[model samples]
Target: IIIGEKRLRQQSKDPRTPPSHQPEADITPSPSPRPRPPDNLEEGEVEEVCEISTPPSEVLVVEGQADEPFSTDHAQRLIGQIMVWNGQIDRMRDQIDSMRKRLDTMQQEIKNMIDVLGRI
Candidate 1:
């Protein structure tokens, strides 16, 4: 009888308790077909490139205007620019790898010297 009354009291208290504290979801829905900023656009410039206009090298959200008023020369220029940038990135990566190997060798040498000193 006592346990039953306690449970009933608990249930009554639960109803009076306020809902769990949680952040309210923003009432506004996120913008659809939102204009994305250009990746290569210079600072202070407001160039909005549609997802469709994104280059093949980029992870495109949506394919931008390809047919309407498209320039073949501009496309070719972008391709050439990507090629040069990719080449530079590859060279820098190689240089970084080489430096890492040199650093590892130097570290091993230091460890060996420390071990020899400990023995002495």
Candidate 2:
């Protein structure tokens, strides 16, 4: 980001100058990165599966013609969702509490059985 800012400042210093007059250091092309070869291939072998391209872009909204994207109904729906999620959380807590009680009962039964076997 700092390098880009420096380039922008350097360019703005002489905005009217032609590209040919610019210093060679700033105009040099950056190195293209090489993709690694697959392990199955022989040594020094490589394969390019795809090429990078610019992504497509489009305007999502136009001047004065854009419709209102929000409503009171959407807000109400969000509140309703919160209530539904809260109910689900309550149900999960109840189920977990019941499961803990069952586990405790099973543990007590196992201890009793062990005690009976020792007595016999």
Candidate 3:
């Protein structure tokens, strides 16, 4: 009888049972609590899983388009883009000026040829 009573008590204390599958039994402390679905838990009774809080970003927020809050990196990126555009525009202007000068030279040569032909 004594041996049988001891066996029953050992079984009860063994954590392999249904309700004792807790992470605490594993003995390593988790940085964050595990999350669980809210069911029959009392309003004030906090579960071990629900005790940890998550970061603000992890919490859900509704969609709304606020003016894009610009950061320094974004501003720097914008400035870089503007500089690239300005360089391209300056290159195009230089090309157009070169083309205009060539056209003017060609026109003067044609006028000189016409005058020489008239003299001939």
User: TM-scores of all models?
Assistant: 0.43, 0.42, 0.42
Q: Model 3: which residue pairs collide?
A: none
Worst 10 residues of 3 by lDDT: 1-10
Q: Taking the tens digit of each residue's C-alpha lDDT, what string does model 1 give over 1-120?
A: 011111111111344554332323223323355545668878887653323222333221223434233368888999999999999999999999999999999999999999999999
- The most accurate candidate by TM-score is 1
- On the 0 to 100 scale, the lDDT of residue 38 in model 2 is 61
Candidate 2 lDDT by residue in tens digits, 48-88: 55443322321122235324434579779989999999999
Point out the higher-scoring one by TM-score: 1 or 2.
1
Instruction: Please provide, for model 3 over 1-120, each residue's C-alpha lDDT reduced to its tens digit, 9 standing for 90 to 100.
Output: 011111111112334543222122122355455446478888788555423333432312223523333468887998999999999999999999999999999999999999999999
Steric overlap count per candidate: 4, 0, 0
Number of clashes found in candidate 1: 4
TM-score of candidate 1 to 2 decimals: 0.43
Clashing pairs in 1: 51-62, 52-63, 52-64, 53-64
